[model samples]
Target: MRATTEEDATARAAVVARGCSSPIRTATGVWVRCGSRIKSKCESCAELYRNDWAAIARSGVFDGPVTEFRFYLLTLTAPSFGRVHRVPRDGGQRVGACSCGVEHSATDAGLRGVPIDGDMYDYAGQVAWNRDAGLLWDRTRRRMRDRWDSLEYFIVREWQDRGVLHVHAIIRVARFEAPTPGVLRDAALSATAVSQVDAGVLVEWGEQARCDAFRADGDGAKTIWYLSKALNYVLKDVATASVDAPIDVWRHQVALGDAARRMRCARDCQPQDCMNLVHKRYGSRSQVVSASRRTRNRTGWSFTGLTRTVQRRLRREWWESRMRDEAGDDAPALSPPPLEDLAARSRRELIARGWSAP
Candidate 1:
């Protein structure tokens, strides 16, 4: 959708008449296809997601020179509500596949994040866990902030060993005072006292919580890059697991049906219900992956175009020189690079290439 300052009410009828279709071509002769993060809907867009988020995670590590701070790889897992289809893992080796009678490949979206027995799967509970997992994570981070003022992090939610949800985060604390693993574990444990998801359903983290200190040298980048893996998952499977579906759709497809149910919210609760709860309480929208305010304000954080800043300037100059040749010798010299943040410069470059704000 086009980014606009306000609604063009007059065009609403015409726009609706056009309906949804494939990606549209821009003035730059580039085809802007459907930007679905789900791989099933659009593989190219998913790849774009992987590249963009990977850079974002990487930038969160080294971009702002978080050198004064120490980084940690923290994992907060969800407590098991019930047994579902799971890919067992031990020491990075497959312990065994799911009980489901099928050979599952690494890229098999259909086989992952599903219940071994749909009838027995706690679909409603699972949805509740997904809803509160982010809050639990925030509580843990707030506890961490008590130790340092300048804290920055990015978290990724993944469907884990069981059909449950867990969080993987890249936590950075300022002042270079790294806490021991035990202390970090204790902080996480205290945060696990998350609010109730239902009448009798209290949300909690699983027994296994890990906090590994990132190496001061270069491991910080590696840790962040590691967590970015979830940005590109089985598109179809994740869509099937969507948390935004209606009650009947979510229950039949995710809670009771054999299809992989990975969508947002709880099985007992409908998507709209869960969304309203989250918005009312937290004043925030639901999202799979998210970053803190400080993390988002990094210098180059928003420069996610195809080329880097210098490369874009060079390309612009090359184009200008060619245009000058056509105008005989009186063409003006190429202007110097703008003295602004990379993101701002990139936005100008996009506009120069014929991108207009709606």
Candidate 2:
């Protein structure tokens, strides 16, 4: 019994050391790492996720002929629903008086996103905007492509302290017709979309948009780094509001949640009965990160064709090779057992352990 317990403890330690805190057995009877992107859930997996996307982002800027393309880092914000306190971050300079007639300090961070007047704040409009944000972006991108035919982009959607979604995009275009940063910013900001669900509503971006062109060999690396860092924000399950939040801040989040819960995510959605995650996510239904994909007529977002799938395949091959090398030529064949046999054996073991087998 002691020997068996010791062996089990050693196996668990090995798994932890390999950065797989949670391993799940697949239908094929192979155990694999749970690919969670949230750092709080699994730091190792989250780091891998961040690193994979970062590599893909870098490939888009560095792999192709640098001088042949123009790169721009663009930021777009959501339209404000109402006035909120503008408290600077820790160690940041103080802004002037807020609309409420108070110069907020960093210590007032708890009220940063809280509405100045809860009754007047457009909670319904904010939630509705969040629901339609993806559609708006689709229209915006199409409009931009109409002017610049060679546009390819990678975007990360970040949550503002005010519980709204904003965009940070790395955009690439052929140099023949690249526009000035100011022009690009103007064009993007001017683009708008009509909501398909709520036909009467018009979707638009806030006036706080920016676009900055950078050289692929110079500021481009720094721009990529900045966007890559935003990936960490994407891992959060929801808005930053917490249980111990200030009363006003808590009420603000509650209002957003209530708004989201009642908002129609789809044309056929029944708010009370819908099980969609949109209700729990502050009315946003879009993915946190995405990139252009390769098509017959396009080179895709990554110039070197480095994507998460490619990274995974490469990692798996390297891992297998290392395992074989460690086993040595004198050892038995390091190849895995046949899938069918493994599956049958796994089923029997599961049944013996009083667990259902798929």
Q: Estimate each model's TM-score.
A: 0.58, 0.86
User: Model-by-model lDDT, in order?
Assistant: 0.52, 0.80
- Off-target runs (Cα >4 Å) in candidate 1 are 1-21, 24-33, 84-120, 192-201, 234-236, 239-253, 256-285, 295-358
Name the top lDDT candidate: 2
Ten consecutive residues with minimal summed lDDT in candidate 2? 335-344
**Taking the tens digit of each residue's C-alpha lDDT, what string does model 2 give over 147-173?**
999999999998888899999999999
Residue 313 accuracy (lDDT) in model 1 = 55
> Against the true structure, whose TM-score is highest?
2
Q: For candidate 2, what is the TM-score? A: 0.86
In candidate 2, stretches whose alpha carbon ends up further than 4 angstroms from where it belongs are 1-17, 241-244, 330-358
Q: Give one digit per residue, the lDDT tens place, for model 1 in 145-252.
A: 677556666777775533456677777665566677668767767765444434454557788888887764668656765776664542235334555543433443
